[model samples]
Structure formats: C-alpha cells, structure tokens
Target: MPIIELRTEIKASKEIVFDLSRSIDLHKISTEHTNETAIAGKTSGLIGIDESVTWRAKHFGIYQLLTSKITEFERPNLFVDEMVKGAFKGFRHEHHFEDLNGGTLMTDYFDYESPFGILGKLADKLFLLKYMTDLLAERNRIVKDFAETDKWKKIVA
Candidate 1:
C-alpha cells in the first residue's frame, strides 16, 4: 500500500473548507483536465455520511469508473471515504479540517493499493505515485483558491 499525506492552509472557516472539500460540483471543476464527472449517487452538492458517488474520468488516455462511499463523517472536523468499486485493489481517503487562528488547516490522507501484485508495485514506484500525488495537489489548489475567495459561494451556496 502507498500512503500520501498532504496538508494545506486555507484562509477560510473550517465549515466552508469542509463542505467545499466534499462538493461534487467543485470536484468536477477542479478535475476538468481529466474530464471527471459524477455519473451516479450524490452527483452534486456536499456528500454526507454513508453516501456513495460513482465517478467517471479519463486518466492516462484511458477512461475509468470509480465508486466511493463515505464511511465516516464528523461535520467540519473529519470524514473518510473508501473505494467501493474501482481499479485499485483497495483505496481510502481521509479528509480532516481544523480551525487554526481563524483559518482552516486541511489535511488529506490517501492510501491505495494497485492490482496485479508485483507489477502494480512497480507501476507505483515508476510513475503512478507521482501521478496520484499531482492529482491530489491540483485538487487542493482548486480548493484553496475557492476557499480563499468568493468563488466558493457559487459551488457551496
């Protein structure tokens, strides 16, 4: 398994950051390069506890579908989503938010394992890890841009 931990400081309230992080609409916008879309289940707005979303996206010149279910939720504090069905052997993403001097400190914990055993490990080491990390960084950049500006209202309101 490969684990990725990322932290971003956003100049916004924890509530705003938390909600924006789970917004399907915002995700679509952030991943426009990949042509990501929510194809089923909670396709819009904030995803709450136990809700699942099926996403279709183009990655590495290939189209893939992934479904994830929110397994844990604690409002503006924390949430966890795990893969229900996807191309991976297993995957889990945890989002955490905390108020820090009037701003929000957002953290992401991403864990994933690819299929095909040894070949998967090689792929991860060769390029998949960097690719996934870049995707997450891009997503966070979009979240930060929205949270620090008025653009968030368009998605969250």
Candidate 2:
C-alpha cells in the first residue's frame, strides 16, 4: 500500500472548509480537468456519513468509474471515505480539518493499493504515486481557493 499525505492552510472557518470539502459539486469543479462527474448517489449535495457516490472520470486517457462510501464523519473535524469499487485493489481517504488563527488547516491522508501484485507495486513506484499525489494536490488547491474566497457560496449555497 502507498499512503500520501497533504496539508493545506486555508483562510476560512473549519465549518466552511469542511462543508466545501464534502460538496459533490465542488469536487466536480475541482476535477474539471479530468472531466470528473458524479453519475450516481448523492451527486450534488454535501455527502455525509454512510452516503455513497459513484464518479466517472477520465484518467490515464481512459474513462473509469469509482464508487466510494463515507465510512466515518465528524462535522468540521474529520471524515473517511473508502472505495467500494474502483480500479485499485482498495483505497481509503481521510480528510481532517483543524481550526487555526483565522483559518483552518486541512489534511488529506490517502492510502491505496494497486492490483496485479508485484507489477502494481512497480507502477506505484514508477509513476502512479506521483500522479495520484498531483491529483490530490490539485483538488486541495481548488478547495483552498474556494474556502479562502467568496466563490464557495456558489457551490455550497
């Protein structure tokens, strides 16, 4: 398994940042470059504990569909989503938010294992890890940008 952790500081309340992070609409916007779309289950609103979403996106020049469920959720603090079905062997992504001085510190912990055994490990080491990391970073950048500005209202309201 490979784990990727990222931290971002955004000038916004933890509540706001937390809500924005779970917004299905915001995710679609953030991943627009990948043509990501929510195709089923809680496709448009804030996703809560036990809720699931099916996403379709273009990655590695191929279209893939991934479905994940929110296994744990604590408002304005933490949430965990695990893959129900996807390309990878398995994956779990945890989102954490902490209040700071006039802002919030958002952290992402993504753990995943690829299929194909040894060959998958090689792919992870060679390029998959970096690719996934970059995707997460880009998503966080979009979240930070929205949370720090008034643009969040468009998606969350």
Candidate 3:
C-alpha cells in the first residue's frame, strides 16, 4: 500500500474550503485526468459526512466506475471516503481542514493499493507511484488555485 499526503494553507474560510473539496463540479474542473460526475447518489452541491457518491470516469485510458461511501465527516473539519468498488484493491481518502490566522489549512490523505500482486509493486516502484502522487498533487494545486483565485471569488461573493 502506498499513501500520499498533501497539505496546503488557503486564505479562505473552513466552510469554503470544505465545500470546495467535496464539490464534484470543482473536481471535474480541477483535473483533466478525470471526467467525473455524481450519479445516483448525493447531488452536486456539497457532500457531508455519511453521504456517498458514485463517479464514472476514464483514467489512464481505462474507463472506471467507482463508488465511495463517506464513513467519517465532521463539518469544516474532516471527511473520509472509502472505496466500495473500483479498479484498485483498496482506496481511501481523507480530507481535513483547520482554521488558522483567518485562513484554512487543508490536507488530503490518499491510501490505495492496486489489485495486481508483484506487478503492482513493480509498477509502483517504476513510475506508477510517482504518477499517481503527482496527479493528486496537481489536483490539489488546482483546487488551491481555484479557491484562491478569482474563480472562487466570484462564486463565493
């Protein structure tokens, strides 16, 4: 299992950051690697604790459909989603937020493992790990950019 953790501070409210983190629409806009949309579950507004959503998308040229259930959610603080079904053997993501100096500190924790045995380990060592980590980092960067830039200013205002 490989885990990636990313943290960044944003000059925004905790509520704003938390909402942006769970926004499927913001997610789609942030990452070109995914074409994701919420279907048959929580609608595209904001997802709270215990809310689940299914996403259909293509990753690495492979079409994948995954359902994740929210297991832990604390408003403007923390949220966790665990994979129900997907390409990966296991997947869990946690989002955390803390208020600081009139801003918010946001963190993302990703833990996942591939279905393949040794092959997965080999791939992870080669580039899979770096690729996936970079992808998530980029997505977070986009989120930060969107949240800190005029994009969010207009929306939040």
Q: For candidate 1, write residues 1-157 as lDDT tens digits.
A: 9999999999999999999999999999989999999999999999999999999999989999999999999998999999999999999999999999889999999999999999999999999999999999999999999999999999898
For each candidate in turn, the TM-score is 0.98, 0.98, 0.88
Q: Report the number of backbone clashes for model 3.
A: 0
Q: List the residue pairs that clash in candidate 2.
A: none
Provide the lowest-lDDT 10-residue window in model 3: 148-157
Give the per-residue lDDT digits (tens) of candidate 3, residues 48-67: 66777888877778778888
What lDDT tens digits, residue by residue, belong to model 2 across residues 4-33? 999999999999999999999999988999
Q: Give RMSD (Å) of candidate 1 vs. truth.
A: 0.6
Candidate 2 least-lDDT 10 residues: 148-157
TM-score of 1: 0.98
Q: State the number of backbone clashes in model 1.
A: 0
